[model samples]
Target: MTSISQTTRPAYSAASPRSDGLSTGFYKLLFMTPTILVLALVVAGPLLYSFWLSLHEYIITYGMGDLVWFENYAVMMSDEFAGVSWVTMKLTVIVVVLEFLIAFGLALLLNQSWLKFREIYLLVLMLPILMTPVAVALMFRLMFNPNLGIINWLLSLVGIPQQGWFGDPDLALATVVFVDIWNETSLMLIMLYAGLKSLPQDPVEAARIDGASAFQILWHVTLPMLKPVILVTLLIRMITALKSYDLIYMLTQGGPGKVTETISFYAYRLGFRFLDIGQAAAVSFILLAAVVVLTVVLLRIMREN
Candidate 1:
C-alpha cells in the first residue's frame, strides 16, 4: 500500500517556478506592466509636463517663452504672495482648531455609554457632510446675503444689526470659517468616535477601579492612546483646508480686497485670470512642497508619540 501511494504522488521539480513558461516573478511583472504604463501616462506625464511649464515664462497670449529657470518662483517674494500666504495660514489654523474642538467635544458626548438616540444624533450631524461643498457654499451665500438673506432677518428679530457676511472684509473670512466648521466637524467627529470605540477597555476599567476620575482617565490614558488617530485626522483636515478653493470661489471669490484669498485661489488667479501659467504652476509646486513637509512633520510626531 505504501509503495502504491509513493508511485501515485507526483515528483518534485526544481524548475516548478518556471514550469508554466514564465517565472513567478516574471509573471507578476508582466501582469503589473499595464498598471505601471497607465500610471505613467495618466499621472506622471501631466506632472512632468507641469514641472516643465513652470520652468518657462508661459503666457497664454504670448505662448511659451524661453526657459527662465527659477524666475517664476520669484513670485514667492512679492507682497501679494505674502498676503495670500498669511490668509491661507490664518484660515488653515482657525478652521482646523475650531473644527477639532467642536468635533472632539461631540465625539466625547456621543461616546458616552448612557447617551440616548445616538444613531439619530449621528445622522443629523452627518447631514451637512452629505451636501457637496459647492452646494453648501451657495446655500450659505444666499442665506447670508446682506439684503434679502434670511439670516439677516433672523438677526434683526433678535435686535442685532444686519451685517455683510461674505462681502465685508472683516467678516468674510469668519463667515467662511463658520460654514467650513459646520460642514466639516461631522467628519472629525466620526473619526474620533471610531478611535474611541476601537480603544481597549482594560486601561479605562483599571483606571476606574483605581479611583481615577473620568476627566483624569480621559486626559492621561484615553487621550494618549488616541493620539495617533488624532494626528491622522488633523493632518487630513489641515491638508484639505490648505487646498481650500471651491468654497472661496463660490462664496467670497477672494473679495473685499483679497482678504479671503488663499494660495489655491491665488494660483487659479495667476493661471486662468491673469494668464501667467508659469507662475501658476510654480505656486502649485510650492503648495505641493509645503504639503509634503507638513505631512513629514506630522508623521514624525505620530511616530514619536
Candidate 2:
C-alpha cells in the first residue's frame, strides 16, 4: 500500500523543492535592482526633471516662475536658434565626411602587406586618439595661433601668406572641423582596418579569378562586406560630432563673433552664463531631440541600404 501511494505521487512535486524557482527569481531581481535604481537616478530622473523645468520659467535668483508651458520651446525655435542648429549640422557633416575619406584611405594603405614596419606606423598614428579631447584641442590651439604658430611658419617657409586660422571668423569653425578630423580619423582607421582584416578572402579571390578590376572588386565585394562597419563608424562619428563641445571650447571658446558657436556651447551660455535655466534646459532637450532624430534617420538609412 505504501509503495503504491509513492508511485502515484506527482514526479516534480516529489523531487524538487517548492522554493527553488522562487528563490532563483528573487536572487535575479536582487542582483538587477541596483542597476535599475542607478539608471533611474542618473538618466530617467534627470531627463524628466529637465522637461519639468523647461515648462516653467525657473531662474536662479527667483524660484520656479509661472508654468509657461512650451514658451521656452517656442523661443528656441526662433531664427537665432535656427542659425546655431545649421552651424552644428554643418560642422557634423563636414567633420564626418572628411574623417571618413581620410580614414578610409589610411585603412587601405595600412591593410597592404607590402608595407614595412606597419605595426609601428599604426601605433604612431594612434597616438592622437590616446590624448584627451581638451589636451588635443589645447595643443592645436597653440599650433593654429597666427603669430607664434608652426602652421603659419610653415606657410611662410613656402612663400604663402600666413593665414589667421582661428582668429578669422570664416576660418574658425572650419579650422576646428579640420582639428576634429585630425584627432578622430585614427578611430575610424582602426575600425575599418579591423573590418578589412577580418573579411573572408574567398569572395575577393573569386572576384579576382573572374577578372574583376581592383576598383570593381573593392566597390562590389569589399565595400558590401564592410557595410556594417561603415554604418557603425558613421553612426558613432555623427553622434560625437553633433555634441562637439570640449574641443570647440578649448580652441576658440566660440569666439571671433559667435560664428563658431555650436548648439552645445550655446546651451551652456544660455543656462550657466546667462542664468536662464529654464530656456537652457529647453535648448538642451531640443538638442537631445535633434540628436535622437538624426540617429534614427541614420539607422533607418543604414537598414534600408
Candidate 3:
C-alpha cells in the first residue's frame, strides 16, 4: 500500500511540473518585459547617449570629433560657469522660500471657515498655473513695462518712480523670481490645503478646549504635524525653481547682461546658441548632479521625520 501511494503521488506531480513551470515563467516575463523596456528607453538609453556625448567634443557644424575626456567638464567648472551656478542657486533658494511662505499663508486663509467664495478664489489662483508660462511671462512683461504700462501708471499716481521690471539688469532676476512665485504658490497652497483637510481633528479640538489660541495651535500642533507635506512642497518647488527657464526666457531672454540666466538657460545657450553639444551635455549632467544631491538630502530628511 505504501509503495503504491508513493508511485501515484510521484506520477501526479510529474505530470503537472513542466506545464506549471512554463506558465509561471511566461507570467513573470509578461509582467517584467514592459517595465524593462520602459527603463531601457526612458533611463538607460538617454544616460548612455549623454555619457557618450560628454566624452567627445561635439559641435553642431563639425559634428562629433575626437574624444576630449573631461575637458568639457573642466570648462564648465571654470569661474564664469561657477558664477552662473551661484546665481542659479540663489534664484532657486529665494523662489522656494518666498513661495512656501506665501503658499502657507494662502492655504491657512483658504482653510478658514469664515472665508467666502472659496471655490472661486481657488479657481482664480489656479488660473495662473494653468496658463501657458510663455503667455504669462508676456503678460507680466507688458504690465511691468517701464513706459506705457499699467504698473508704472499706478506707481505714478502714488508718486513712486518707475523701475524697470525686465529691462534693468539688477531687477530682471528679481522680477522673474516674483513671477515664478506667483505662478507656483497656488500649487503649494493646494497641496497644503489637502494636507490640512486630511489632518485628524481630535488634537485640534483638544487644543481649542485647552484654551489654545489659533496661533498657538498652529505653531505648536498643526505645523509640526504638517511637516511631511511642507517638505514635499519644498522639494517640488526647489526642483521646479532649479529648472526655471521658460518664463525667464520669454520675459527677459536672460538679457539685461545675463542677470536672469539660470542653469537651464545656460545649458540651452551652450547646446543651441553656441552649438557646443559636449559642453551642453556636461552642463546638463552637472545640473542633474545638483538635483540628485538635493533630492537625496530631502528624502533622507523625510525618512528621519
Candidate 4:
C-alpha cells in the first residue's frame, strides 16, 4: 500500500523566475519586431539611398555616372550657396521670433477665464491652420498681385500708393515673411495654449497670493516653467522654416533675384531645373546637418534647464 501511494503522488514542479522573465522579454521583442522592420524599410532606406546619390556624379538623363566622392559637397563654398543660406537663416529667424511673440500673446489672452466668446476666438484663430499650405500660398499670391490684387486696391482706398509686394525685389522677401506669419502663427498659438493649459496652477496661485503683478508673474514664474515648451516649439518651427519650399514655389518661384530663396528651394532648383542631382543632394544634406545640429543643441538646452 505504501509503494502504491508513493507512485500515485502528484508532481510539484514550478517555473523558475528567470525562465518567466526570459519568456516575457521574448514576447515583448516578438511584438516589436514588425515596427522595427517597418521603420528601417521606410525611413532608413530612403536616407541611405539619398546619401549614396550625393556621393556620385549622377544626372537623371544620363543615368548614374562616376562616384565623385565629396566633390559635390564643394558647392558649399560657392557664392550662390552662401546667398541661399543667408536667405534661409533670415527667413527662419524672422518668422520664428515674430510668430512666437504673436502666438504667446494670443495664447495668454485666450487662456483668460474672463474672456468672452473664447471658443469663437479660438475657432477664428484656427481657421488658417485648417487650410492647406498650397491653398494659402495661392490665395496670398492672388491677394498680393500688384495691379489686380485687393491689397493694392485697399491701400488706394486709404490714400496710400500701390506697392509691388512680390514683384519688387526689395519687398518680395518681406511679403513672403508676412504670408508665412499669417499661416504659421496659428500653429504656434495652439502649441503655446496647450502648454499653458497643462501648467500647474499652484505656482500661479501662490504668485497671486504674494501680490505679484501679472507681467511680473509671467516674467519671473511662468516663463521659466514654459522654457522647455518654448524651446521645443521654436526647434520644431525652426526646422520647418529651414525646409520651406512650397510657398516659394507657388508664390515667388525664387524670382525677384533669389531674394526669398531658401536652401530647400535651392536644392529643388538644382535637382529639377538644373538637373544637377549630385549637387542638389549635397545641398540637401547640408541643410539636414544644420537641422540635426540645431535639434541637438536645443535638446541639450532643454535638459540643462
Best by TM-score: 1
In candidate 2, which residue pairs get closer than 3 Å at backbone N, Cα or C atoms, i.e. clash? none
lDDT of 1: 0.91
For every model shown, what is its TM-score relative to the native structure?
0.91, 0.89, 0.87, 0.89
Write down the worst ten-residue block by lDDT for model 3: 11-20
lDDT of 1 by residue, 1-305 (tens): 98887667543333345546766667668899999999999988988999999999999899999999999999999999999999999999999999999999999999999999999999899888778999999999999999999999999999999999998999999999999998888888899999999999999999999999999999999999999999989998999899878999998888889999999999999999999999999999999899988889887877886
lDDT of each structure? 0.91, 0.87, 0.86, 0.90
Per-residue C-alpha lDDT of model 4 across residues 1-305, encoded as one tens digit per residue: 97777667533122324534555456668899999899899988888898999999988899889999999999999999999999999999999999999999999999997999999999999889878889999999899998899999999999999999988999999999999999999999999999998999899999999999999999998898998889888988998899878889998888789898899999999999989898889999999999999889887977887
Model 3, position 87, has a per-residue lDDT of 83
- lDDT tens per residue, model 2, 1-305: 97887777654343344545454446668899999999999999999999999999988788789999999999675887987888888888988999999998888889876999999989988888888999899889899889998999998988999889998988898899888987888998888899899999999999999999989999999999999889888888888888879987888877787878889988888888888989989998888987898789788877886
Write the number of the candidate with greater TM-score, choosing between 1 and 2: 1
- Which candidate gets the maximum lDDT versus the true structure? 1
Per-residue accuracy of model 3 over 82-148 as CA lDDT, tens digit each: 8788889888888888888988898888888789999999888877778788888888888998997
Residue clash pairs of candidate 4: none
Worst 10 residues of 4 by lDDT: 10-19
TM-score attained by model 3: 0.87
Q: What is the lDDT of residue 178 in candidate 1?
A: 95
